[model samples]
Target: MGGAFVAAALLARLGGRIGLPTIPLFILAGILLGPNTPGFVLVADPHDLEMLSALGLVLLLFYLGLEFHMDDLKQGGRRMALAGGTYLLLNVGAGLAFGFLTGWGTREALVLAGVLGISSSAIVTKILVDLGRVGSPETKPILGIIVVEDVFLAVYLAILQPLLSGTNGPGDAALKAAKALAFLLLLAAAARYGTKIIGRLFDTRDNELLVISFLGAAVLVAGVSEWFGVADAIGAFMVGLMLGSTTSAKRIMTLVHPLRDAFGAIFFFAFGLSIDPGDLPSVAGPVAIAVALTIVMNVLAGLATAKMYDFGRGPAGRVATTLLARGEFALILATMAASAGLNPRLSPFIAGYVLVLAVLGPLAAGRSDWLARVRPGEPQPELVGAGK
Candidate 1:
């Protein structure tokens, strides 16, 4: 873990110079320390990394949800839903089609579709915030799309868990899904109505108590979500949504940002630690093919989404680029595949693919202004018009 931190910091510095995300760098550092790589700092115990990694992922999702206020749907419901729905449908369709074309079976194809359809909410949201695009015209719809994808993420996992676990029959699958759905609905209702209770208890002036309350709520909810067969990420996210509704949301966000970055680094590093670098060589070709497909599809779907939201060509193109980076969620899905024994090859293949695209995705987004060649319609700021 000590070595992982040092390696990630160095790689992140390198990534900053090259317009890549620190996530891929973190992962690359782990891969270098993996069994297959002849590195001085190999990870001796992968299990120890799992809990921290899970916490990192959970925090990342929670931060994202916190940043995205629930009021957004009231402001931009139709367009956001339509645009996000469009992206999901198209990307999933494309993923399934490609999976079938390449002779990956139905189950593999479904998993692949999930792997393809979802973008890394953590990465893209962070990038947008860092780039100061959080207030841009395109941001509203982009965030909306992320929220929609997250909703589907919970549903997909709920449905997939039973199948992957090899439950006895259809009855078992239905029962598991019912349990998950009921829990999720309860969570949603809590986020809606329970905010007042939280506001009363936690919306206080005591900064230390405030911090404890926020962290405690997120972690407790995440554990409960896991207990009920719902993904812990979902629980953290829903907790975030509830927290964000409070008057103390900004203070909570400020306090949590540092924690998110620290644990988020572990999450990415652990992904790389899980992979055997020696296996990457055999998977490179397929990984490249998959990357190409996702990039093209993301651009198309993302562009349409931006246009539907009435963004200019430049912002639309930028939105497409922003959508390219697939981080935590992809890794999560890939890891799920590996754990279930449903598709061993899927894990390695996706690990390699994510390494490349994770880098390329951010690089492309950083330079997205190259595609902003349009008649000067709406005057834009220097950053939106041209890359610095």
Candidate 2:
């Protein structure tokens, strides 16, 4: 753990000096020091970091929830839905079409649809914080789209399970989907009506006790969520949401910063450790095309979101680029594919595609102004809190 911390921090610091995002640098540190590459191996087994990495993911989303107030939800409710729906229609539809074009078969197409469709909530949350855009005008929609995708993921995975696992029947798939829906609704209800009750539960002045209560609740809820077949990250987020409305929200957020930063770095590092650079080459061409497709689709989606919210080019670019990274969830799909014995190339394609965008997402977001400058257009009204 010490070695992982040192390596990640050192690389991130070095990269920070050069104006690079710490995210990709942390991943690069893992790739360079991991056993997959020829060099000093800091950690021979990525599994050693798995639990910590999962905690990192949980904490990241939990922090995101803390920042996303209910007022934002009420204000952007309809527009958020429309923006999220537009994003899904463009990206998921394109992914399915691209999957079929690859001629990898139906199962592969189904998997690819998810891989290409969902944005990495973990990465997106990190970008929002790193770029200081968490409070930006477009962030509400960006997060709303992520929430929408989480719901879609539950249903998509339910559909994919029977086809891939062979053991799960349509009945099993329906049950899983139902469980996911129930879990989300349960969380939503808690966030809506149980805020005061939740506040009372964690209302304490002791710093140590406060940390223990919130951390335990977040992780426990996240674990329960996974058992119920929903994304653990979503579970963590909802936990944060419920707690964010509490009187202790500010205190909890203050305490969580260090934990979120530390664990989040490990999450990215573990992600890099799992990927073998050699595998990326074989699927480079396909990955390139897929990355291009994601970028183009995201741009269209961003424009649609901008139009809906009356945002100008800068905010639209920020919207597109901020949501660009694909990480943990894509890897989850890759693991499922490998276990199901689908196309072998699918794994590498996902790896290469994720790595490129993971790196590119932060880089692009940092320079979103460049996107705004593309083909200079007529002056437009800028939305409040939308500037870079």
Candidate 3:
């Protein structure tokens, strides 16, 4: 922990001068101090660390929800739907094609495609925040699309879990889908009404009470999701979204930011520690393939979303560029896949791929403005017309 803190501080202090994101530094520190390197050996019990990481992830999602509003989603829903739908289709199609060409079985191919189709919202959101672009017009649509995509990915995983686990047949898959849909509907209704009641129940001036209430709600929803055999991350995220629409969302976020940051650091550090350096080279080929596909798919999805919203080339390109980074969700998916017995060989590959992208994704997003400015054409209306 001390080493991690020192490294994080050094990176934060010097990262800007060196053109590196602070996150990559933290990751690199983890690799160096992890079992992979000789710097230090800190291996906490996996179950305990994962529980801590899970808490970090929950808080991260909660903050994401605070940034969201029903009106924003409603306004951008069409474009988000278009971008998310097309992106998933392309990713799954391409992943399936790759699997078939590689001689994988149908079920295995489907699982691979499903895993690849989803991008990491947690990573993308964090990158945007780091770059201070979260409030930018270009950022809004990208985030909106991610919000929609997250919902879809959650639903997809819910269905895929049973099938992959051999715990359910096709009929059961249908039932699971129905249950997932019902859960979404119930969540939406709760967001529309439940948040208001909760807000009234916990006065904003009572910060401790508000925080406790917010966390309690998050845990309750997460428990509900687990009870229904869905991923807890989905439940946490949905609860956040619902709470985000409330008047108290901002306060909730402010109260939780410090706790979120501390635990979130632990979460990412744990992710780094979990990686085995010995296996990295062996998995490099697959990781490379996965990273390349992530970049391509994210860009394409961004462009498609931009075009759907009638955004010009610059904004579209910027949005697409910004969406390139992968983080928490990717890890979550990989972890889930490993547990589900997808392929032992694939786990490290996916982890390595996520780590690579987590670093590169932000670099790409950070440079998006420079890229946009140098593009040959009329500047984007959103960029040029702003403050006019």
Off by over 4 Å in 3: 1-17, 22-24, 99-115, 122-137, 175-181, 302-306, 309-313, 369-388
Per-residue lDDT over 92-188 for candidate 2, one digit per residue giving the tens place of the 0 to 100 score = 9999999999999888998898899989876787788877988787888898888777656655664565467544676876777677778778888
Q: Rank the candidates by TM-score, best first.
A: 1, 2, 3
RMSD (CA, Å), candidate 3 to true, equals 4.0
For all candidates, the clash counts are 0, 0, 0
lDDT of 1: 0.79
Q: Write down the lDDT of every candidate, Cα atoms only.
A: 0.79, 0.82, 0.67
- Candidate 1 deviation (Cα RMSD): 2.9
Candidates' RMSD to native? 2.9, 3.7, 4.0
Worst lDDT run of 10 residues, candidate 3, spans 379-388
lDDT of 1 by residue, 1-388 (tens): 7777888898899877856678778888888876657757568667779989888878987987787666776777788889888889888788888777667676777788888788887678767976767777777777788878877887787677656656678898788778878888898888888988877878789888987888888889899987777778878988888888888889989999999999889888888877887778877887888888887787787668756866666776777888887878888777667766865678778888777777777777767786566424665564444443
Model 2 residue-pair collision total? 0
Highest lDDT against the true fold, candidate: 2
- Please say which candidate is ahead in lDDT: 2 or 3: 2
